[model samples]
Structure formats: structure tokens, C-alpha cells
Target: MFECFCCPVCGQALIRESQTLRCSAGHSFDIASGGYVNLWVTNRTHAGDSKGMVTARRRFLDSGAYGFLLNRLCSETAAFLRGRGEKDPLIVDAGCGEGYYTAGIAAYLRRQNIPATVAGVDISKAAVRAGAKRGEEVSLAVASLFKLPLCPASVDIVLSVFAPVCGAECARVLKPGGLLFIVSPGSRHLFGLKEILYDDPYENPPNTYYLPGFRQMRQFSEKREILVRGGQMNDLFAMTPYYWKTPADASARLAHLPTLSTPLDFHVDVYERCEDDAQEPPVCEHQTHNQ
Candidate 1:
């Protein structure tokens, strides 16, 4: 489906080769065998996602700690697309770390009999590389969200889960009748872990915020109290950003605890690009909670 992608370096048309994508201006990038193309040219590396961080993320996600959240996202996204009579949609996940959620959503779409082309892009080479190793069918790319490689108005659905959102870039790449879905942690998400980690746990404000270009269409929160026993507690802590900042004493405190139950609250927000002639907002029907 991606015959030509824009060069992130110069915005030129990047010609697709069997093994490399070459732009007219001599900027060439290699396409890995696992179905990912690296297109990042900048050096602004993320400190939080080093090689060890990516590994920790993959291990934690693979352990199924976040499987419930993944399943919810898939079901809701499928329902949203079905209600709009959208089939064979092209979906992109910006800042997709390790491809856990992206791959999960792709499988869910397939089960719903929806023809889907899912692409996951991240600036971290380690994250994208790990994602590419997952398998074919899901296209992984090493590209920044600020400058997506897709052409304007080319995508049908875009997802950003606990990651940065470039509203202008999203609006540019989304088709006229496209939807943008975002999943952010609620105010009380992982409160138990926060309490153990920070000396001032109250200082960590809620992470959810609305962006500028996108108008909110629908918002829902999923809250579940999960009792994590044994090693799962460590995995839970490792999967979150708080792990990076948590003090050694806090880590020890969590490590010593045999069992910890925490509340997991996630907010799913969907937005639609406003058009000139559109009069009414998009229709959103809430589904019964599967829990």
C-alpha cells in the first residue's frame, strides 16, 4: 500500500527498493527484512528508551501485564470503525513502542473481517527494531512523529497510546473522513505504584491533555483494580515511565512487597478532523464494559 513515502530529511519522494528506500537527493534508507523502513535522520535520542529500556518494555508487555488494556483498545477501535461503515482502513500508530498494542490491534481487526494495513513508527531504533522482529503484516518504521513519512490525507485511522501526538501532522496525514484515537492514563492510574515510588507521589499530575487541532468527539475511562502478585509487580513498574524516576529505596519497597494491587485507569479519546461542509459531530456509541 505504501508505494512512495516522503523523505524525512528533505521531504522528497522516497523511491521504494527491495531493500532500501532511496530519495532523488541521494538520501537512502534500508528496509529491514521483517517489514520495517528506517527513516530517521536526527540525533535527538530519547534517554528513557535506551537498549535496556526497550528490552524492559518488551519483556513487560510480553508478560501480558497490559493485555487487558490492549484488548480494550482493539475492541473499541473495531466498534468505532464498524459503526462508521469503514472497511479496509489504513491505520498508523505513532510512537508505537515495541509493537505490542499495534500488533494486538491488527490481530483484532483481522478477526473482525476488516481489511487493515497497520504501521507502527517510532524514533527509537531499538524500539522499532524490536517491533520489526515481531513478524510480517505489521509494518514498523524508525521515524519521528513530528514528521511522519506518509503523504497528506493518506491514513484512515491514527493511534497514539501514552505517547506524543503531533496534531498538525496527524491532521495532514489523515484522510477527510478519518479518526484519531488516543489512550492516556487517567488521574488515578497506577496510584498504588506511584505511592510507593515517589517521595511526593501527589506531585505527578494527571498526564492527559487535549491537543490543539483535534476536537474531542468521544471520551471514556476504563478502570480496573488488578492484584499483581510476585514478579508481576516488578514487570508492572518496569513498563511505566515512573520506573525511570523511582528512587532505589522506592524500588526496594516495591520489591519487598509480595503482592500489590493497583488501580489501572485508561482513558480512550476519539477525535475527527473537522471539514468545511460538515454540520454535525461524528456519532459515538458506547459499548458495555467487557470486564
Candidate 2:
């Protein structure tokens, strides 16, 4: 699936030899027993969600509370490929945590008998391992979004779900006219959670993305109410940014929430890479505020 991956060190093509991925330059990355590869170098900093966070997220997502969001994402992706007339597509799940959407999208294509490939990448090896548990439908890897391990112009579609977006990095790995589907949290996303944490909670601020060398193609707003029990609520809360931002007292309140209702709002924006010389002056990404 990752036959197009490159060496992070020398930028040479990586060939899978046994359980190791090596380039002609001799740079090698070992594949974990869990069916995932770690291609990240520069062990200077440890960023990304912690192992505990990954576990919590997996448990919460496995509960199917976000099933609607998952299904919508995969359906929209298939429609996007069909609309572009690309029968065989190579898709990337950027910042794929626990491989939820990664496996979901891959399985959707397989069920519809579409010829395509899906790969998942994240900076966290722990997260990649958990995601690998979903099986081999996805080529899992430990990679930084800032510098993806794939070769230039190698991928057709890139999916960024509730993850940080690196426009230049995405553009670099995508074909000249490739498509990028980014899912950002809408203003109402997790407003209920915030209401429980902050003294005066506010709606999520609109995220601003600047994608040069690309133009908006399409967008969709998805809003749903998720009802979660105490355990599920705890897992969901621990996996979010609020876990780090909320104080002890506010956190105490979550333990008492036997069942909580929250809004799951996502603004999915699609951008198409323009011809190298046809890109317009850079500007803010166009997005609708899903209330």
C-alpha cells in the first residue's frame, strides 16, 4: 500500500525488506509487530497525544457515538472521487488517530468495489499501534504531518479530520490537481463540554487556514447530538484538548455526568491543488460557521 513511501532521511525511495523499510542510501525504519512502520526521525521533541489519551480516544470512538460523522466522511469521500472521474484513487488519512476514519474510508471503498488505496500517518507511534489493530486495510505509519514520508505528487486525496493542517506539506505530497478534505471543528463543537468546564463558556472560534496553490472546491457542514454515558463521557473528555485546559473542579463535575448530550459539529472543506503557475495570491480559506 505504501509502495510510494520515501526515506525521511535522504528522500530516497523506501523498499520494504523483511520487517524493515530501507532506502538505497541505507536509511532504514523498522516496522512494528503490530503492522505499522515508524518513519519519524529527529527524536528531539515528544509531541502529540499521550498513550493514555490514545487509549481513551479509541474506547470512546469504538462506542459508535460518532458513527454518523464517520459514515458521512466516507460517503462524501467516495462521491468526491467519483465526481473527479478518478476510478483508482490513493487517499491519505493525515493525523489519523486510532485509524477510525482511516479504516472506515478504506472499508467503504472496498465494499463498493472501488480500486483505491488508503494510508494513515501520525506523529504518535502509540496512536499508530492502536490504529493498526483495525487490520491491514490501511498502511499505518508514524510520521510527522510537517514532513510527510510520502513522495511528492504521489497521493490523490488527503483527509485531515480534527487534526492540525499543514497546507504546504499537503500540497507538496499531492498531485498538481489533487484534492484535500479537511474536517475542522465547528463553532458549536463541544459547546456542552465547555459549558461544564469554563465559568463562561463560549463557542469554538472559527479556524482559519491559508492554503496557497489551492482553491476551494466544495464544503459540508455536519451537526449531530451525541449522548454519552459516564464512562464514555470520561473517555471523550480525556481525549480532547479540554482535558488539559479545564481545572480540577470542572473535571470533578464530569465524573457525575451519567449521561450527557453534546454537539458534534464539523466543517469539512475540500480544496483542489491548482496548476503550479495558476495559483492565485494566498488568502484565508473560505468556511461556513456551522452553528
Candidate 3:
């Protein structure tokens, strides 16, 4: 299922050997018991989301508060894959977090009888471990989006949902005319929750959907209101960027509320990759590391 991983140390293709992925240069990465490989070759092991944050995200997402978003994403993905006319498509979720959307999309495609190879990559080992528990259909890798372990021109579609966009690296990995799907918060997203957290809440600013070596193909927006209890509300807050920056007083407001209704607005933007000879190649070395 995961035949596209490259060596982080030597920039060579990795061949899976039982519980390890080894390269031609003798560099190897061990696959975790949870069925994920740590391709993040760095001294800092705990980089991305913390275990607490992953737990909060998993709980909040599994509560079915974002079921509508998942359904829409599946539908959109199936439609795109059908139009592509590939017998077997390769889909990569650049920052899959805990694999909620990754697993959902894979299952949805299976129901539609579309054969797809899904790969989920995240910088957090904890998040990838949690993602592995979802299923083995998605190949989980603890790798950075900026410098993916994927080979050149091998992927069909790249999905980035509420995650950082890596333009040049995406272009290097995606085949000619490949699609890049970016999902972000739409205007007025989480406004209801914001109202309770702050005295003056502002609507979310417009999102920029531009990326190098890619042209905008389509844009879609969906919104839904969901009621969440205090515990679930806390989970929601903890999973977002606001939790770290919000004042203690603002956070205390949710402690007394029995339930809170919030709007979840998401914008999906599709970009088609274009050939840019001037585009630079992906940087393989992370701060000049040696094998």
C-alpha cells in the first residue's frame, strides 16, 4: 500500500522489508507497532500536535459534529477521481492529523468502488499513531509536508485540509495535471463559539488559495450548525489554534455553559498542477544532515 516512501537521510527510494523501510544507501526507518513509519529524520521528535491535542481532535471529530464536512469531502473526492479516469489512483493527505478525513475518504471511495491508495503523513508521531488505529488502508508516515518522502511525479491527488500548503514540494511529487485539494475555514467559521469566548468576535478573514505551480480550478463552501456540550466544546476549543492564545477568562466562559451552538464553515479549493520549469526542486536535506 505504501510504495512511494523515500529515504530521509540519503534521498533514495525506500523498499519495505518486513517491519522496516530501508534504502539503497543502508539508511532505514523502523515501522511502529501501530503500522506507521517514522520518516521524520530530526532531533526534535515531538514536533506537530501534542498527544493531548490529538486526543481532543479525535474525540471532537468522532462526536459526529463534523460528519457533514466529511460527507461533502467524500462526495467531492469521488467526483474528482471519477473524472480523472485512472484505474488506480494515488491520494496523499499531506497533514492527516489523526486520520479522520483520511480514513473517511478512503472508506467512501471503497463504497463507490473506486480503487485508491491513500497515504497520510504528519509530523507528530502521536497523531500518526492514533491515525494508524483508524485502519491500515492509509499508509501513515511521520514526515513533514514541506519535504515529503514521496518520489517525483508519483502522486495523483494531494489533499491539504486545514493544513499548511507546500507548493514546490507538492509540485515535485504530483504528476502532470495532478490535483491539489485545499480545505480551510470559510468566512464566519466558528463565530458562534467565538461569541462566547470574546466580547467582540469578528468573522474570519478571507482565505488566500494561491500556490505556486498550481492554478485554481474550483472552489466550494459548506456550512452547518451543530450543538455541543461543555466537554465537547472544550474539545473543540483545544483542537483549534484559539486554545493556546485565548485568555483564561475567555476560556472560563465555556465552563458554565451547558451547551453551545456553533457554525462549522469550510471552504474547499481545487488547484491543478502545472508544469513550471522555473520551479525549484524539493530540498531533501534538513539543515545539512548526513547519513
Candidate 4:
């Protein structure tokens, strides 16, 4: 089902050994029994997949708090593929944290009888390992988004849900007519948590960086207010990065929150690669000089 993978470094065929990937260049990466390979070679790992973070993410997702977002993502992705008349789409979730969202989408596709090859890649080995342990049908790999371990123009669709996006790399791996779906938290997402954690939430600014490589095709938003009560509030707090830098009183405040109704705002932006612009010079000239 995952025959499309290749060596991240040499771009050669990756042979699946007992629990590892061996390329023609003798670069071998061990695949955890959970069925995901670790392909990250960088020394600096992002703040992802630590035991506590993974556990928090799993607990929060399993609670069905994010079910609405997952459902919307699955439906939109499926509809997009169906409209394009594409069959057996290859999908990958970049920065797939704990595999909840990836697993959810894969299950949705399977229920619809859509032939698809789903793989979730992350820089966190722990996250991929957890995803692998979840079972088959979804391949998990510890790889960087900046350099995906796949051949050029191989994937049919790419999903980036609350994760980072490397526009150039995504465009390179996607077929000419493929689409990339990005889901990001809107400015108002998690406002309640922000209000409790920081004294000046507005001063920190928000993430509004947009990709420059692809043309925007469609944009839609999904908002749901969840009334998180009891211990689940703590789970919600831990799952978010806001808790990390929060003051000591943040946790206390969360614990005291009898009922927190926060908006879960997510934006789904679909973009198609501009084929004609593929051969054009660098769009960000400053990047060339920095290199």
C-alpha cells in the first residue's frame, strides 16, 4: 500500500527490511515495530512528540473535542478528490502530531471506499512511533517536511492540518494537477485559553504567514464552541503550546474554570500549484542572497 516511498537522502528505491528501510546507497533507517520509519537527521528537533505532549494530545483528541474539525477536514478532502475524478489518491499529513487527525482522515476515506494511500510524517520519532502502534492502513514516518522522503510529483494530495508547510517541497512532490489542503487556526481560535495564560495576549501577535508558491483556490472556515468541563479542561490546556509558557497561575485558572466555551476556528485553504510559474526564477530574491 505504501510503495511510493523513497530514500529521503539519495532519492533511490527504499526496500523494506524486517523493520527498517534500506536504500541503494546503504542508508538504512530503522522502522519501529509500530510500522513507521525515522528519517530525520537533524540535531534540532522541534517541540513535538515528547511523552507528555503525546499523551495530552491523545487524551484531548480521544475525548472528541476536535471531532468536528476532523469530520470537516475529511469531508472537504473527499469532496475535492471526488470532484476531480481522481482515484486511489496518495495522501500524506505533514507534521502529523500523535496521528489522531491522520488516523481520523484515513478512517473516513476507508468508510467511503475511497482507494487511498495514507502516510503521516513528523520530525518527532516518538509521534511516528505512537502512530505506528495504532495499527495498519496508515503508514507513519519520522521525516522532515522541508525534505519529504518521496519522489518528485508522486503524491496526489497533501494535508497540513495545524502543521507547517513547505510550499516548495509540497509542490515538488505533488503531481501537476494535485491539490494541497492546509488547515490553520484562525486568529480567534483558543481565545479563552489565551486570555487566561497571557496578560497581554494581543501583544504577542498571531501567525498570518501565507505560502507564496501556490494559487489559492478556495477558503472555508469551521467554528465550534466547546464547553470543556472537569479534568478535560486540563487536557485541553496541556495539548496547547500556550500552557508551556503560561504563568504558574495559568494551570490554577484552568482548573478553576468551571466551564470554558472556546471557539475552535480552523481555516481550510485549498491551493493548486501554478504550473506555468514552475520555471520562473526565485520569488523571494532575499532567500537566494541568504543562501
- Predictions in order: lDDT: 0.74, 0.82, 0.83, 0.74
The 10-residue segment with the lowest total lDDT in model 2: 282-291
Give the count of colliding residue pairs in each prediction.
0, 0, 0, 0
How well does each candidate superpose onto the true structure, as a TM-score? 0.85, 0.92, 0.92, 0.88
**Which 10 consecutive residues of model 3 have the lowest summed lDDT?**
282-291
Ranked by lDDT, the better of candidates 3 and 4 is 3
lDDT of candidate 4 at residue 203, scale 0 to 100: 28
**What is candidate 4's local distance difference test score?**
0.74
Candidate 3 residue runs with Cα over 4 Å from true position: 276-291
The predicted structure with the larger TM-score, 1 or 4, is: 4
Model 1 residue pairs with clashes: none
The 10-residue segment of model 4 with minimum total lDDT is: 282-291
Report the C-alpha lDDT of model 4 over 48-155, residue by residue, as the tens digit: 558777777778788888888888888977887788676667888977878887888888988997778888888877777777766758978788878888888878
Q: Tally clashes: model 3.
A: 0
lDDT per residue, candidate 3, 124-178, as tens digits?
Answer: 8899999999975888899988889998888889988888877777788888888
Local error of candidate 2 at residue 263 (angstroms):
1.3
Looking at candidate 1, what is the lDDT of residue 252?
Answer: 98
lDDT of candidate 4 at residue 242, scale 0 to 100:
68
